[model samples]
Target: MTPPPEDLASEDAKIPAPASPDALRDAILSVAAGDADSFAGLYDATSARVHGLVLRVLRDPAQAEEVTQEVYLEVFRRAAGFDPARGSALAWILTLAHRRAVDRVRSSQSQSDRDVAYESRANTQEPDPTGEAALATLEAQRVRTALEQLSERQAEAIRLAYLDGLTQTQVADRLGIPLGTAKTRLRDGLLALRRIVSAPRQRKEE
Candidate 1:
């Protein structure tokens, strides 16, 4: 596996010995008190073990690296609530890493399942030409209405680029405007169109 970044690595030369449990606990306490140096030391000393556990659960180097960073961020945010009576500092940190890794795995699986289900439905559904034509007409009407909401210059830019199938450069040439101005019009027009089109759906959802 690829090693972590240099800045994240422990500065072993600075300390003659490995981090003791007492030292880790002290670091956590200091971290809770907003000591930046203590937080850095804690991360350096414990990151390897934390990352290893997360990587084992995730089984993907890139994802493990991301989750390890997230785990440390959570540790920093919630450090003030660490309870020595309930558990050791290392155990607490490890638990956070494990939980975050598992959550990532579950979230990935859920998204995959949703994609599979959508594909299955799309494949099995029968085509209805009449209904499809009606739907397409309604969609086109909606889009035209949305286009009407934009300024004439913005609307002209969108139609030239999208409906006329012109590149931004071509659109600029056709409109006799600078390429940057053409891009700005297209961007603003699309944003306004999206808001206009989605307003009805937003109201229904609410």
Candidate 2:
């Protein structure tokens, strides 16, 4: 386990605006060797870029800020395994930030899906062939229209996962994205559907 950065030398804690690649690499190495002060320097040098990448992926400034902190903690623990031959230190750090951000988005989306699913199940009605046939047709039409409200990727995700009965893993593979991203798309698509479906009810109430 990496120790906390509290005991680091105050003199070395000050970070430059944007350290050179060589400088960043050296700081990572120092952190790997249990130099907290060097990790602070690395954090200062690359934090904005890390946060920006996370924000682009997540589109939530609050979540991006939280994930940026996680990225730095991960860097402290994993810096020992970094191979400069594989990539630049900045690339490695940004990759971690992106992954963490995606994970958060996926988790949040999955929870939303679950909530929507539970509500749907709770509201399920007993079948009436005469009424059911008409309702099913109407529901199908509503779904088709609602799908149109999604973004292109979200629509594709919904078609692949729900309509085609593919698992999330399968959708991820088909889309060539991480499973987290696939879940996020599906979640957003479902949320859109829920909103579209509810809009009529809201209008009637109003």
TM-score of each: 0.51, 0.50
Residues 1-206 of candidate 1: C-alpha lDDT, one tens digit per residue? 32233322242223333488789889988876666667767877887787777786789986787677667656765787899887778777877887888889988998799788879788766546678579968866886777888999999987776555566677889989997788577656655665566678679999
lDDT of each: 0.72, 0.70
Q: Stretches of candidate 2 above 4 Å error?
A: 1-17, 123-206
Query: After aligning candidate 1 to the native by TM-score, how far in Å is the CA of 184 from where it should be?
Result: 38
Cα miss at 19, model 1 (Å)?
Answer: 0.9
Residue-level lDDT for 23 in candidate 1: 92
Cα RMSD for predicted model 2: 18.1
